[model samples]
Target: MLNAIEMILICLVAQAALTDLALRKIPNVLILSGLLLALILHLLSGQPGAPLSQWLAGGCAGFFLFLPLYLLRGMAAGDVKLMAMVGAFVGPWQAVQIAALSAQLGGAMALWMWWRYSSKVSVGIPYGVAIALGTVGVVAWRHH
Candidate 1:
């Protein structure tokens, strides 16, 4: 069940990356799919439909966790939605870890891109790529 969740997460992230790369936006379908997949995974894992408290906490956590960045326009709406969906799946702590890992990898990629492109780091980073990669990383680490 977790494996399926992981696969869906990775695929959704990849879809986000691809769409963002090609059109500078992530499709609504991709985000919805991810959210739905997480909900299904949670239920399938024999957990309650994510207790209201958990959902509320996770949603708030995920939103606040990335709110400042988004407000600063450092990330897009899709990225934020994706994180919230992930929070629904794994709760606050794991959401934080995933965000951290994604940020770390995304930072590296941005730095490299900056170095290669006039040493200027813009508010925009191709973060969906990092998310896609980090989802796989998180899933692997958690399973192990």
Candidate 2:
């Protein structure tokens, strides 16, 4: 049962990573799909309406977790929402940790991208890839 969500999340994370790497953006459809999936799964599990606290925590974690990077122009707003969706399914604290790790990975990758393309184009790497990858790492670590 839980594996189902895990699979879905893993797949989506992979897609997000690819999109971020290729297009430099995490599409709205992908993030929306994740939220919809969690809602549908929550309903199917007979939990109809998940506790408001959980959703609130998830949203809060997702937003504030990425705020610093956003302020620093290190990431995008879309990535923040994406992480929130992940939090909506996983919870707050874990989501924060995942975001933190992902940000670290993203930061390192961004630096590399910057250096690699220093003379080509002035742009930042799509950090959604890092978030998705980081989330996967946290999930696997949590389960193990």
Candidate 3:
């Protein structure tokens, strides 16, 4: 059974993926809500370590991880924000794992799209799906 944090992360990423697929944009409102929820959950978790710092660091790690790609025009801002939202839930270490896994999945998706569409592949891929899958996979693996 998934905990509250896991459930919320899943719901957040699922919504992000859906919106990204349909609109090619992940709303800032969603991201902001997820971040706020993560902060509240972390505060209530009552872990020994500094929960606030962990949350901030995790968010920064996730954001910086993809900032370069965004700056390079390789990805959209929504994708970066989505990752940061995931990070806020899981923390920096898991966020890194999710980013790596998401990159692999995104690459596979890109390859498939390239092969299938050939010269007609102009639309941006909905990378939030990869991020969502990666986040869910890591959370499941950690809990299992």
Candidate 4:
């Protein structure tokens, strides 16, 4: 059985992935709503396994994990914020795992796109898809 936070995290990430893939952007509304809901859930639910400090650390870790890529113009601001919101839900260590997995998934996607596109046109990937998928993987792993 999934906890409330876990379910919300899945829904939020799924929504982000859908929006990102279709529109090529992850909306601020989704990220902010996810963060706000996570904080509220933490405050009200008294969830086990992680305290508020750990949640904050997770958010920070998630933000910093992708900050370098964003700074290098290799990623979008929405992707960074999306990961931070995911961190707020999953906590620090899991967030690290998710970020690492997300990077691998994103790289695979890039390679696939490169191979699929024989033309030399530049194409930007919506990394939120990778982040969402990675988050789902981590959450599913925790469940089993």
- lDDT of each residue in 78-113, candidate 4, tens digit only: 999999999998888999999999999999999998
- lDDT of each residue in 7-120, candidate 2, tens digit only: 787888889888888887888898888888866665566653564555557767887888777798767878877887888777688888888798789889878987888858
Best by TM-score: 3
Candidate 2 vs candidate 3, lDDT winner: 3
Off by over 4 Å in 3: none
lDDT of 3 by residue, 56-103 (tens): 888988999989999999999999999998888888998999999999
Better of 1 and 2 by lDDT: 2
Better of 1 and 4 by lDDT: 4
Task: Work out the TM-score per prediction.
Answer: 0.82, 0.84, 0.95, 0.94
| Each prediction's whole-model lDDT (CA) | 0.72, 0.78, 0.91, 0.91
Error of 3 at 114 (Å): 0.7
lDDT of 1 by residue, 1-144 (tens): 366666766777778888777786777787777666666666667666564544446655666777788898888887787677666656787778888898899899888877787655444676777766776788779877
Report how far residue 19 has shifted in candidate 2, in Å: 1.3
The C-alpha local distance difference test score for the whole of candidate 3 amounts to 0.91
RMSD of every candidate to native, in Å, equals 2.7, 2.4, 1.1, 1.7
